[model samples]
Target: MHIALVTETYPPEVNGVAMTNQRLVRGLLAKGHRITLIKPRHQEAPPAEHASLQVHEVFGIPIPNYAGLKLGLPRPGELERLFEADKPDIVHVATEGPLGFSSLRSARKLRIPVSSTFHTNFQDYCADYGAAFAARWMMAYLRWFHNQCALTTVPDPSLIQRLEKDGVQRLQMLGRGADTVLFSPDKRDPELRRSWGATAHSPVALYVGRVAAEKDIPLTLEAWAAARKHCPELKMVVVGDGPVRKKLERQWPEVHFAGMRYDEDLARHYASADIFIFASTSETFGNVVIEAMASGLAVITYDYAAGKQFIQSESNGHLVSLADRQSFIQCTESVIQEQSKMPPIRAAARATAINYPWSATIDRFNHLLQKAAKTEQITPQIDIVSNSEQSTL
Candidate 1:
């Protein structure tokens, strides 16, 4: 099947969206499906063209106050033209941006079946931008936009109920997976542990993700501080970089900042850590939490969305009620103080992550596509206006 994926962000961005979408697209290719990736062009990108898979580019403006990121504006004519030439069997939008909305409208214009993925909490993002009242408007717009698609996929099931209550239509439960091979305890290096000031049996607490405002990173710092109060021998390590790096480094001078990592280095960081602390309540799915667990690190996150669905409290990891700042800190302390009894927790954490394989997730997605195509009434092919100069699809 020919699938066109539209998103504002793609590879080299080093965020959840880029990493997850890369896995999905690569999985789709391995499953013998054709994918046309449509995204905003980065500065000094490979090219506006592609061979194995088609790549349609659009002018991107820097996201306000987010210098490292670029947001796609409407490229309606360009998309319409591309669709006219290389008609996809289905259109999948991975982000809700100007490019996404343009694809939705163009797909409707051409009478094609389109699908969407709920990858971000756009409404919450509005509040993060100091426009709290705009959240309702954003939510309403999301309801309208997603309702136009034949299927809308969300990574977390609990979000389905919430979206349905808000008048969303035809939601699909699509979960993501972790790379266990790259995230296992075997990757833990004795030398790396020593670098973090960790002894053979000392606890090494770690956080591996973007350090941003919405991540509630201050709470994580507090939890670590609480944990340290109980276990003075504990070593703290942070393996990712973001806007908050300078402030975080200054705030905790003793903690190790490994900075942004990828490939084997990232794996080593995950494996070396004894426990993972994630305080974010804004994620649709906690990719790092699963990655940490797959690496055999006990996880501590909120009891909602990703964590609540996978964690069974004392069984695998700790899942405190959302925004329970004090409880979260106390839980961290408990784990560190009682660190000797962590074998069962670590084992359970690994076992829980075993089922989350990219192959399985992609297989289910393929099944959903087959089902949708079989059940959906076929629409007549309409040529999308394919003028290279025009920027709408």
Candidate 2:
């Protein structure tokens, strides 16, 4: 099948959405599917080259407060022209940005099957950005935009329920996977742990993600402080960079800040750590949690998204009540106190991760796209409304 994928971000972006999209594209290509990838061109990165993959770069502007990310601008009729020239069997929008809106409009104009994936909680972001009042409006817009698609794919069942409750139609659960081979306990390096001033006995707490306000880094730090009071030898390692990195570095001078390590280095960071902490409540699906678990780190996260989906609390990992900062801290202390159970918990975490493979995820995605295409063939075509004319409607 020839598939057209529209997204705002792609490879070398150092985010979950970009990485997942790249993985899906490669997986689809491996399955002999021709792909047309439409995304924003990164200034510093070279274009991706593949035999079955066709790349289309569009104009984009840097997203405010997101240092390395860019949001694609709407192209009125460009997508329509592309689709008409070499029409695809199906269209998949991996983001809900301006580019995605245009893609939906273009696909509809061409009477093509179009589906979407909900990767982020943009409405929840409004609260983090001090625009809480706009959350309802943003959610309403998202619901309307996704309802236009043949299907809307979500990463978690919890997200499907929440979006359905909010009146978002055609919701489907398309779960994520982790690279177990790349992220394993075998990747642990003694030298790396020593570099962070962590001894064989001293526990290392790891946090890997964007160092931004939306991540609730302050809550993680607070929990670390509480855990440190009991385990004095506890060392914190933050493995990412963002807008608040400078401020966080200043505030917690003792913490080891390994900014933006990818591939093997990232795997080593995850493996070398003893425990993983994820404090973000804004995530639609926390990919880092699974990555950390796959690396054999005993994860302590809130009871939702990936944590609730994958973790078997106290067995594989620990799950605190959502947004309960005090409970989050207490759970951290419990993990610290029961150090002997860490190995078993870590083993169970790795075992759980092995069940979720990329092949399975891609297979499900391909099946859904095929189903959507088949549905489009049987359904009657409707008049296409261009995105530019959406405001008037």
Candidate 2 regions exceeding 4 Å error are 377-393
Per-prediction TM-score to the true structure, in the order listed: 0.91, 0.95
lDDT of 1 at 206: 90
lDDT of 2 by residue, 1-393 (tens): 999999998867888898899999999999999999999877866656678889888889998767778888856788899999979999999998889888887888788988999999999989878899878778877877787888989999989999999888888889999999999999999999999998988999999998988999988988888999989999999999898999999999999999999899999999999899999998989999999999999999999999999998999999999999899999998888889989999999999999998899999998998988865533333333335445643
Ten contiguous residues minimizing lDDT sum, candidate 2: 377-386
Which segments of model 1 are wrong by more than 4 Å?
43-51, 65-67, 74-76, 373-393
Q: By TM-score, who's the top model here?
A: 2
| CA-only RMSD, every prediction | 5.5, 2.9
